[model samples]
Target chain A: MRGITIGQYYQADSPLHLLDPRVKLLCTLAYIIILFFADNPYAYGLATIFAFAMVMISTVPVRMILRGMRAVLFLALITVLFNLFLTPGDVLVEFWIFTITRQGAQTAAMMALRLFLLVLASSVMTLTTTPNKLTDALERGMRPLKIFRVPVHEIAMMMSIALRFIPILSEETEKIMNAQMARGAAFDEGNVLKRAKSLIPLLVPLFVSSFRRAGDLALAMEARCYHGGKGRTRLHPLRYATRDVIAYLVFAAFLAGMIVVIRLF
Target chain B: MKLILDHVTHIYDPHTPHARTALRDVSLQIGEGSFIGLIGHTGSGKSTLIQHLNGLLKPTEGSVYADGKDIADAEYNRRALRGRVGLVFQYPEHQLFEADVFKDVCFGPKNLGLTQKETELRAYEALQQVGLEPEVYDQSPFDLSGGQKRRVAIAGVLAMRPEVLILDEPTAGLDPGGSREILSLIASLQKERGMTVILVSHSMEDVAAYADRIIVMNGGGVTMDGTPAEVFAQADALKEIGLSVPAATEVCRRLYAAGIPVRPDVTTAEEACEEICGCFLR
Candidate 1:
């Protein structure tokens, strides 16, 4: 069950990990936006190359990135299949009432490639940046929203805390499920309704424990004099370095190249 | 039924990046109707070993034989084995989710396919065994005190009428009085019912007072196995592995170190007191 690696950070001492998280987050956003404009074959090729470069430089195992892709593989396949059957264009193949058109197949491939690259690019951000650093970068990047009375720090902290609890709650759920299983609770043997009913024993304890943990955490935060990020000081303030500037410039060049490629093609 | 683990090994998340060897090439025999105390520091594979007793976890290598039948065999009935070997996990009460204590206790026997009457009878008998009063039967288990809820949870397992009972830190997070009550209840159940009881605990004092045989686990293997007296005699060796003997045994050791005529093997407070008194009288 621990194989769920979405939003999980992989620890490594690569250039990606050393880059400022703010820069990485912005670059990820830019990369994703660039994917939408990557309509032609050349643009798609450039996007794929950029993603591969990012993954290679991050030094995270290709296996880990592909594991994250598993979650979206079905969606990508569905999108491709739908476009192959649904779109109108010059027909390439005909089978039983369905026509595979040239435009439809191209559109399907492009959509699938877009989705795959989008997932891979976003995963690269989460894989390299720790949750704490991600939150810090988010808060720093959203500081402009303070003019609209947005609680940027609080929002970022809440997001980070939620992300932090995902694995913990999952582990707790596994423990509870195992405990119930030891008592002859058959989780897998029943019909759909029965299987869900079997989960009552698992879910009740999990909810109770989660509430208790949240209360305890709140009390702990209060004890530590936490007051909603008001006048709060950070031990490691987000700082932009020379490498971060170079990374931003490189991504900007990539974005300009993507736009030029799309226009030329 | 006698339980034999022959060179059992277990690995968690095998072949993955997070793969961990929780137990390795560990073999032991648990005779029927024996009260065995499993003692170990945290992460010493004590939990993993007990889970193997009933086939809750299959050994990665070797085999587990219950009553001379290999449980790891493909045709083995694991559900029946689970019914025979009941496990009460740490904070077993957390697993309780029934509307009332009585219904919660009835879960196991019901799962065992017992008739309504037989299930109720087993639940009542098990509740009595755990010393929970009749009045709390109709109340929600969540409303009970920590100790009471834990007893109810144990009653749930006991209702299965297991031949071999395994408890993992059953007294953990309880007050001293509550811990004593739970341990004594387990002792009585083992004695009166002749049930094979395997208690996994961190408290050396509790095991010293109650268990006839003690097994020490360290670094995914059985490091020491003997009677409590024999095991506690090698206090220095146990200490080297980050485990300690009972307080009474520690006191006896100190007195023996001071050149007093007291046996360092004394494990209980009563035994220590008697030995010190006898030394003074002599």
Candidate 2:
């Protein structure tokens, strides 16, 4: 149950996944800025089309995008409802005490669209790039923080290892749960108190196993000469390619178009 | 304590996209006080089948009855059920978490909400049963050797005072001496407590030497159920499932093949020696 997909990464051979992570990350920031500045239906529509085009280029299955959408549907609904009812504007409809205003509806729709695009674009990046490569890029980008003693390399390496082990630990948990259950530890039959009590079997074992794994992994890392990521040379160095330059150019065009659409219309 | 599973089927993550059938209409009965050896290759549903015996899993469309009581019944307190049916998991040492050995072994009984004094007594008795020193009670479980950690984990379950003690690969990854020690401990425990012990193992020699009855599982179904002598006789079938006959069984078979009139029921080195001598005398 713990091996939940926290980030959306659609595995595709599309142009989106092929783009450098730094470029994609910067583009995502720019996209969010453009989305926030989008005030009218036309500007929001342009941003939506741009996001849709990116999704198409990434070649991620539409169903996966919808699945991702379903996971955060509740949060999206809350955001939309908060904007619609809380924002004071020209009232278009009224029910009981809650009033839906014209401008509020427009604001709600634009906000929802912005969030959806933001998540999708980020997912596209994650889906295409391995976590190791992504972290490498992040560490390289954050190298300027070395002057401030930020330990960017260490932080990135930690994140990479954590991502790598999430699935492994999840599988271990399932095995342990199965093992305990086989001995008559039914996890499902309980009141709230009983349920919490039931968790003792799972939690105790899980913690023990994780700690044991942590010890083993630490020993393994030490044995392999992993010494705090200091002076480590990479086999695949990060470099900005032609594709990355073109990706940035496209992002700039999208940003400019979004501004023009929002300001002119 | 006749544990009967009636046409039991189990699917993990049922109705999800990752739905998988771990067991398929597998029916078997483990007779009370019988040391039943459950043998199978990996993912053969041996693990899944045992879970049903203690009510860890509810079959998708069947029932499991322990001592003629439906284990899946809503009225059955599962925690209480676990107290009766002890399960020692594979690499059980990895389950140790309490800072001290005493508290670690007492986890199950404490979970049962036993009184402080009673819990202490059971924990001590269980530790002694596993051949651990009372002085080691205050020692960190993490500080112990791999075998000791396993013993402490087993003692934890033993503190529950279970009627049926199920072990999943109890001797897994242990050295030869450690394996022998654990097997002997289990044998003595069964004899002393008359506990219905279900040992899941991939080692045919261990099962042959110890188990009175052996249940062979393959692809989520009970392929064979018989006495060790009865099952080992079908050496071809056992080998087909990537399992081998007991060493002595193999020796006797070879002796028989070499035109020696040795008795075929022998499953240990001593038994094989005695039977071969008897054949020569005859």
Q: TM-score, each model?
A: 0.96, 0.86
Per-residue lDDT of model 2, residues A120-230, tens digit only: 667666766778777887888899999999999899988988888888778777776765553344577759898887777677767777777889989999999989868
The docking category that best describes candidate 2 is acceptable
Give the true-structure RMSD of model 1.
Answer: 1.7
Off by over 4 Å in 2: A7-26, A53-102, A127-130, A140-152, A175-208, A227-253, B279-282
DockQ of 1: 0.64
A27-130: candidate 1 lDDT, tens digit per residue: 89988887887889899999999999999999999988998898899999899999999999899999999999999999999999999999999998999999
Error of 1 at B83 (Å): 1.6
How accurate locally is residue A232 in candidate 1, as Cα lDDT from 0 to 100?
A: 89
Looking at model 1, residue A200 earns an lDDT score of 88
True contacts kept of each: 0.57, 0.29
Tens digit per residue, CA lDDT, model 1, B1-282 = 889999999999998778999998999999988899999999999989998998878999999999999998899988788889999989864688888999999988888888999999999999999999999999998888989988998999999999999999989989999999999999999989999999999999998998889999998999999999999999989999999999999999999999999999998999999999999999
Evaluate model 2: give its lDDT: 0.82
